[model samples]
Target: MNNQDDIILRTDNLTKRYGGVHALEEANFTLKKGEHVAIVGDNGAGKSTFVRQITGVEQPTSGDIFFEGKRVEFNSPLEAREAGIESVFQDLALCNDLDVPSNLFLGREELLFKFGPFSILDEKKMMRKAKEVLERTAIKIPNLSNHVGDMSGGQRQCVAISRSASFASKLIIMDEPTAALGVQETTQVENIIRGLKDQGVPLILISHNLRQVFNLVDKIWVFRRGRIVGEVIASETDGNEIVSMITGMQGGVHEKASYI
Candidate 1:
């Protein structure tokens, strides 16, 4: 079992290179259990690249990843999820034709029975579980049977978040989760994030919206030119200071607190 004070995820000298291009270079980062962290950067700041390496969408050119006090190497996204790390990307990764329950149990559908060579989906069980999960997260979808394609952007985003939260046992990573959402929808998503914090679920959020970052996360990790330029406690800093750090206008004061 992981202690509350344990480092849930840590990257040491993490780097990724494509030929001569250095997408991410020597990033040392840590996320503690139940801590909410935000990754912010301008375009091409290697934010997505960092997420890709950790999520097993791509291999790091060099470095080590430690999770829950154990070193791990995830060869695919499935491996990451199996290790109790769930990510909800901007795309949401839902089947437009499927309903909420189907999307929630997409790849790992519950099996009702197996006959010879066929196994059937336990959809009723999945639907019940889905409703429970949404309730736990304080998320309300008026119709769980509605197809994803018919739902509004915010509803779709909530479905993706609900799926991740339902299955995630260790950490949850969200990439621009509210970028396409309207004000009301964004508020709804923020409430879900707050609910996660109250539940003591560690989260890593990647976003460019400074207001949301300041409101939702405890710490901010700024990336610039393929490198992590700074890590600031949200309570001690503001958007201007973070923006300066991102633009390399000022040197970041490295906090003396132990990171990993």
Candidate 2:
């Protein structure tokens, strides 16, 4: 909020297109240090598309991304993670067949030997570390030996979030984190989000739940028709104002369309 130095992430005219159809167009957005912001809109409003671009799941057609005051163009999700950006998509991306520890250390497994493909897994060590991560995030999974597929939806969602929180050094992004969850499960996930805020970790949450958005984030960014239409402080705005922006009915209809 102070200046560019205070910004953890910033995008200048970020755009994405498929043929002539623009999924996301010139979306200029920002997140400051230790701030939580939500992206809310109707379907096809470009929330996920914008997130995909930021997480390096897809390259932007044209834009400059600044993270921690340095310009960066990530070629893949791996690159983005290495640069301290971790994302939890809707799929959760956990290995269903693998047990909790294995899923937690899926790609970054510990090895007893220095071998590549033939390396012996240090299963005990990975399990210990996984337990530590779960504890740190206040996530409870009774048995670390249980296959992730055997767990309930909420536990699996917690695992995905725990994994992201454990490794995210700079920023964490969540897309529809609680869309598939029920009331109890949603509360569990929301508590985890609050934990992230307590740690002062900056986050970008994409959610359609205005109630949840109002409860969690410091600011709300409304997207309409592939473009970022408006931003408002969460404490100062209500659901109706945000709904108006999403439906292009805030200003006159044509006036809102002018952003596109």
Listed in order, each prediction's TM-score against the native is 0.91, 0.93
**What local lDDT score does residue 53 receive in model 1, on the 0 to 100 scale?**
91
**lDDT values of the candidates?**
0.89, 0.89
Worst 10 residues of 1 by lDDT: 251-260
Supply candidate 1's per-residue lDDT for 125.
96
TM-score of 1: 0.91
Q: Per-residue lDDT for 1-260 in model 2, tens only?
A: 45988899999999999899899989989999999999998899999999988888999999889899898999998889889999889899999999988887777789999787989999999899889988876667899999999999999999999888887569999999998998998998999899999999999999988889999999999999999999999999877778778997754444233221
Candidate 1 clash figure, as a count: 0
Best by TM-score: 2
Which residue pairs in candidate 1 have backbone atoms (N, alpha carbon, C) closer than 3 angstroms, thus clashing? Answer: none
Local accuracy of candidate 1 as per-residue lDDT tens digits, 140-171: 68889989899989889999999898885689
